[model samples]
Target: MFFHIVLERNMQLHPRHFGRNLRENLVSKLMKDVEGTCSGRHGFVVAITGIENVGKGLIRDGTGFVTFPVKYQCVVFRPFKGEILEAVVTMVNKMGFFAEAGPVQIFVSNHLIPDDMEFQSGDIPNYTTSDGSVKIQKDTEVRLKIIGTRVDATEIFCIGTIKDDFLGVINDPAAV
Candidate 1:
């Protein structure tokens, strides 16, 4: 899921950036430090949309660096258990396949795939139904439900399944 939320952070500004361009430097620094970062609580920060407030700067005694309390509005993506998402397949193997939905990598094991689909091993490995009407291979877009998630301070991994009704291939690259 994508959310627009406000988050607070303490930004440290170097002494060289203390002049008139302080605000611009601070915003740029904040973007560099916060964007593309993942946290257990916030998932991944997609982008820094706007600044809500920048509190008074506090100077450090010895380093001369200033710390400012900053509040900013940003967009974040956090996937939860049972959430349905459409992702493009990146790899396929006997064990299962790996797909990516934005910043999250999802693994759909063979056990979770429908029994009707058999794994075919070849130069172009794939999972196909008995009739061959449906197939899953690299670049195939699939709609899957996340069964489990492992959230770390720097990354988020998900286990998904497409066995349920209406949750399968959305677009087949081979068809195109």
Candidate 2:
């Protein structure tokens, strides 16, 4: 059958009745439902499939494991503290700067930005400003420390502090 034709046929039906029908159809197909004599509709699921990224150490998230080779789920978490890692600046915020390394956006806190660098309006990650306008410089690299994390329903945030050498600008011999 054509898609639009099917949609048109459904459109002719009553909205409330259509909704109930759809719900019942889904419950019957996806869930094992029983219309009991007195208990009313009882839903049961002995098993289900095609949930997408579940079971056997595979995480629902697309990212792989932190330790390497062994893959796991991604959530707002800190796998290792004070671990030295390299990252590029993706964004700047009042609270801190977020850098992308692997699948994680590590945070470099405000106090972590070099104290010698002047900031406008006390902005965090203190960007170099000229003529009263703030321009974000791309490709700025910094080492970060895993300090905190904020996990959402779908994404994981690794908050960090750049207050130490391991989290600050790394000495690059090539830059010299």
Candidate 3:
């Protein structure tokens, strides 16, 4: 899920950025520091939207850098349990397959796949139904329900399942 959230942070500005456009420098730096970074409380920062307020700058004793408390609005992506997501399959093996939904990587184990599908081994490994009508392979877009999720400092991992109805391949590159 994507969220528009307001977050506060202390931004440190270098001496070179003390002139005019300091706010612009600070915002650009904040975007570089916060965007694409995952925080346990705020999830993954997608993009900085707008600045709410910039507090008075406090000068450090030795470094001479100015630290300002800044509140800003940004977009974030956070996945939760039972959330259904469509992701492109990246890899397939006997154990299961790996798919990516933006910055989040989802793993769907063989046990979570429908019983009717069987894993096939070859140059292009895949899982297909007995009739070969339904298939999941690389570049396949699948709708899966997140069973579990873990957020780390740099990455978000999820365990997903497609055993239920309406949760499976939505698009197949092979068909195109």
What count of clashes does model 2 give? 0
Badly placed stretches (over 4 Å) of model 3 are 171-176
Error of 3 at 122 (Å): 0.9
Highest-lDDT candidate:
1
Residues 46-84, candidate 1: write the lDDT tens digits. 999999999999999999999999999999999999999
TM-score of each: 0.95, 0.42, 0.93
Model 1, runs deviating above 4 Å: 171-176
What is the RMSD of candidate 1? 2.3
lDDT at position 174, candidate 2 = 94
Worst 10 residues of 2 by lDDT: 1-10
Worst 10 residues of 3 by lDDT: 167-176
| lDDT-superior candidate, 1 or 2 | 1
> Judged by lDDT against the true structure, how good is candidate 3?
0.92
lDDT per model vs. reference: 0.96, 0.44, 0.92
